[model samples]
Target: MFLFIGLVLFGADRLLLLLESRGHVNWRRTGRRDLSAEPTARLDSLLEDPDRRPVRRP
Candidate 1:
């Protein structure tokens, strides 16, 4: 039982580190752009709209 618990904890810690590393890599690869344009333009719009449509409930 103790061995099983140790393995699970170790696996979870590794997974978290992997996810965090990927995010950092992605940001580094594409972290530059004027705050007033294209891809992020949608983000700005979302932030501005107070009544954005909600996702349909399944």
Candidate 2:
């Protein structure tokens, strides 16, 4: 029982590592995400009036 549990835990860890390598999971503690424009860009895009249509001045 103990060996099975150990193997399962190790397998899970390796799976997480594999997923991290493929960019499917961000589990590292040292990397900084590219959030430089997230806040401002999110606010700008979200606060715009969705019901209004844009006008193009030709």
Model 2 misplaced regions, further than 4 Å: 28-58
Candidate 1 lDDT at 2 equals: 100
lDDT of 2 by residue, 9-49 (tens): 99988888888888888765337778875655567677888
What TM-score does model 1 achieve against the real structure? Answer: 0.40
Best by lDDT: 2
Measured against the true structure, the TM-scores of the candidates, in listed sequence, are 0.40, 0.50
Error of 1 at 46 (Å): 14
**Model 2 TM-score, 2 decimals:** 0.50
Model 1 clash number: 0
